[model samples]
Target: MTDIHIQPRPVVHQLRAFTPDLPDRTVGELRRLLGLDEVIKLSFNESPYGPSPRVVAALQQAARYVNFYYDPEGRELRDKLAAHYGVGSDYIFLANGADEAITLIAQAYLAPGDEAVIPALTFGTCAFATRLVGAQPVFVPVRQDLAIDLAAMAQAVTPRTKLVYLCNPNNPTGIMIDGSELRRFVAGLPQHIIVLIDEAYAEFVTDPAYLSGMALMPNHANIVTVRTFSKIYGMAALRLGYGIARPELVAMINRVRNPFNVNFLAHVAALAALADTDFHRLVAARNAEQRQRLTEAFTERGWQVCPSQTNFLFADTGQDSAAFCLALARRGIIIRPGHGWQLPSFVRITVGSPEQNDKLLAALRELNGQ
Candidate 1:
């Protein structure tokens, strides 16, 4: 038999595999290895409180309709979202997740020799997607305080630049860019460049100065905003995310989107979740409370905690983050080590339920011999 061989793209050889915080196999393995009945997970920036009862009920109701494909265009949910934001339905495009939406934007707008501007320490997806599409990702370093340096990013732009990606209440570092600053940044960019902002954690924000990227859409034709139901709605498993842009941009993105990108159950569940504003408020309020508690606890230990408007907290532990995370995992708690993000002494902790938070704090205390 001849050995099978096929030529793959050069970029595929250079790509780094995505490292999820908690793989499913790791969950079971951890339980067995640690002799624990259960393990607490606070690694993925997921909501400690699961999806609203309404989402569950909606999924249950839609279970019988699995035989039929959902609306290929995701019109119902798209229209609902548009109405919610007082935009035309044509302004929205639904994808498997906001991550997919980011990739889709890259696919539709980028090509070889094009360049994308991304923050050095923000969500890895932005850089990953940029590279996946064979475009150069120009990484601009964040400010000393770990906030995005919009001015520096602006200065980095050149004739080759085609896209700019931003993650608000940015992942790992958990610092949000002020709205006014973002407005100026987008406004000053040449009309040829498209600015894609990932606001996956926008719902978790409590800061008054923070602004949604959608607010810039009316004035800036180059603005595209991606949001996900995975965070505050607690629907990570559903993989429902949507993007908002002008009708023309959405149409271009739709060309690369799979017709049935979002499943029926996810569509109905998102619709149900949207209507449950009370549950939304409840989760946001509780997250703020727990976030404050965790901040104080980390500060008490003399660790430097980045001020966060998101559900996760990023802190410099003054120790090896990977080793610290491993120590916590052995004690049946899971968190994200920052080594992958190039912060060897930092870790990103999702604000979990009170009991889960207690477990994490106690594990840290033990590890430090406090």
Candidate 2:
């Protein structure tokens, strides 16, 4: 008799069975669906202005080194960032992007059945990373003003809580928590739980009362601050970001993170961009000006615009935000619908150049019939 052999089929359980329910691609797919060229994308919060001239030059020069492997330690870039932030290189860990840093933190610290507290209206990456590590995400709702409800967050912390994510000048909402309130909240938390502060948009902030997690890092061993060159630095394509924490914490993250996560061009570009102080100032000033212009325009149109301390505005249209976004897309304007953040009536618009902002306002006015 011939011996029979059977191959085992892959088993899918509830934990690994879930598929991502991403919305149909807005800009990329919309361009193909409508057969259009030159689509204006304000959907993703990318810098409207490209990278600094110095960064571009450095990228071009660094292209020659593409054949060689990048430095595994990223020592030069880390030293530059350390000097820029007035911290020691031991306190820093570089990642491909701030998003990757979030994932690394979760992998290093979180265990299955652990809890990570996040704002309900946060960037999806924060929540996704927490879940990827088999940790549950406890979403605390925002206040009526659309800012993080610190009181609720304080109450949400339990014995099993491992991480608490706070996005200053938060994504989607573009609002910030006051320094005093944040300080009180952080002080109240148990020292065992780590507070992950995402400050990707910190450079664009104008409020002096807004606390930088970096400023608080010296006092809290469990606090980790993440910054990126993606937004105001205008190097999203370069994908360079760094984290500051206690040396021990940084070491754990480095151990779990991939070696050579940052490419040669990105490393050089970030270093160049950091040295370009004038470019940084220009981008910050332009974003502030455009943010004010967009806020006033939305207010005059009877839409309620949340006060933004970031590079974007969250405007609550009286009508459905998804419908408004679709209508705006038909006119070649791409704004982000807030459905992903469970904000059905709000849309996020990135601060663009004067001409772009004017064009967006005009489009909104036409749509609202004002």
Candidate 3:
């Protein structure tokens, strides 16, 4: 018999120690745990409306190409995106999702001990992506209005600052930095520091003053504007998103992305979704209606709802948000607790269908015994 030898395991440092522990995406998990057949998930900021019929047809048509590999360059989708945005194909870079794009940006630019400036109340993914690349996240607190404090952000910049992440119609808070304010801030920034402008919810915005980052990208070599099909296009499951930047920056980001990062189905679906203007208008109209309804409902319930330009409302619960989410969950309602973003008294609720919004309002009233 041959003697068996066991190899010693290599000692590895705990990378997780430096990152924040993200709570499980509880809305999906809790639904399964309760064995509920149908869940009104107003927790995640997903479009309540499904993808357009044209998108479904396109996916069905593209199913035959499943046996073949997708285009590594994602040329077709890039062309379509360029036509839609009025930019050259070379200016666009496709990714599996906006989250993937965020990671790619981090990989392309961030280094250990370098700083990435972000608004404290913005999405957690930005922070996670920065830390993943061993970069420090300098969180500049928002103004009393819950908008990004552009002056504070400008001051937050230091010699070590490498990237500035600005989520327009900023997540959780749902407030946007004024266009003039952003322009002045960007103009004043050192050319070495890149600005990552995340406009994931731009389509849902009604404010004329809410500028698209693409408008600023042409002049600023240091700016990258990201958009997602997951929000207005109702294609979160497909996980398609893209970024707009100067061709040079796009090339750098493309080098860092996996060749087949965006799947074949997602490419086809995104093209069709972009073409479905009727569906876009419908979703936008419905979103606006629901946003107003939800805001009124919260106001009537004595909750302070943040002024939102996106398809979600961030309500100050005036109590422990974590506990409030738990109480709402027991009643079969789920909303995102704001503790993850360091706001303990707020909860973010996605704008759902009229029926779903009513249910959420009813649940909130019930929880408060109003």
Candidate 4:
């Protein structure tokens, strides 16, 4: 036995300071541990109605192309998306998911000591990415109504701020600024700051007042709109999403972006999925129906439900959510606990299938002593 062991170098201080904040195990693993016969997951906002049947057929057809390298440019899918938006392909950039786009944005523009502006209690990735880049995240607390406090956010910006993240129909809260307000926000900002709009759940939004940040693109060069096929498209397993920004911005992000980042089958299926308009329509309609039903259900029972445009609901849960979620977990329903993000009296639950939503209601009814 030769003692030829190599020592690993210590991680950087920033890396050491970064803390992980996700559940230890997935729903299925937890289900087995609890000996539950079934689990209704309303944590991650995934489509109850899956991708169009055409997506399945297309993936089967694309099985043969798995041996080949994906298009380095991801041109086909970009072209399809461009056509959908009536924008040029130069404005589009693809990533494994919008998650990767967040990292790419951080990598391209963030330097040590730079700060990112974010809405408090929104998705954690934007803040996480800021810390990853050795930059600081300045969180602007949501208003009393549980919507982003735009005034407070603008006031938080300083000379060191490089980026601002706006999650349209913001995750965990589901409130969004309409087009006019968003336009004003962008117009008022310092010209040098880049705004990254995370629209991961845009497709599920139903409120007519809600607006997609996509409209700002090409018009506002500093704005980057990130979208995904993970939500309404039911293609979470196959990570595929894109960023819409000015061509120069897209080019900057691509510099840090690896060549051929999107895989073969994901590319093939995304293109096919885009073509299935009927399924898209159906999913959107169903989500709207469920979103309304869930909101009313909670409101009738005296719980305050934040007015949501997206496919999930955030409620002032009124107790210790950690223990509450564990109790629901024992009954085989998984929901997101909110206090970890600093909202102790809140919980976020996804708009799931009708049957599953009903199951969750029944469980809550029991626990609520209704």
Give the best candidate by TM-score. 1
Give all TM-scores, in the order shown.
0.97, 0.92, 0.91, 0.93
Clashing pairs in 1: none
Off by over 4 Å in 2: 1-30
Q: Write the per-residue lDDT of candidate 1 for residues 1-370, one digit (tens) a residue.
A: 9987997899998797754444223567768877888898788888889999998988898999999987899888988999999999999999998889999999999998999999898887777888898999999999999999999999999999999989997987889999899988998999989999999999989999998989988888999999999999999988988999999999999999999889999999999999999999999999999999999999999999999999999999998888778878878898887777788999888899998898888888898794
* Best of the candidates, lDDT: 1
Candidate 3: misplaced stretches above 4 Å?
1-29
Clashing pairs in model 4, backbone N/Cα/C closer than 3 A: none
Report RMSD (Å) for each prediction in the order shown. 1.5, 3.6, 3.6, 2.8
RMSD of 3: 3.6
lDDT scores for all predictions? 0.90, 0.85, 0.86, 0.85
lDDT per residue for candidate 3 within 1-370, as digits (tens), equals: 9887865322122133433222244556666765665567777788888899999999999999899998889999899889988999999998888988888999999988899999887887778888777788999988887878999999999999999999998887788778888898899999889899999999999988888778887667899998999999999988888899999999898889999999999998998988899999999999999999989888887889999999999988789988888777776777788877778998889999888888887887787784
Ranking by TM-score: 1, 4, 2, 3
Return the clash pairs for model 2, or none: none
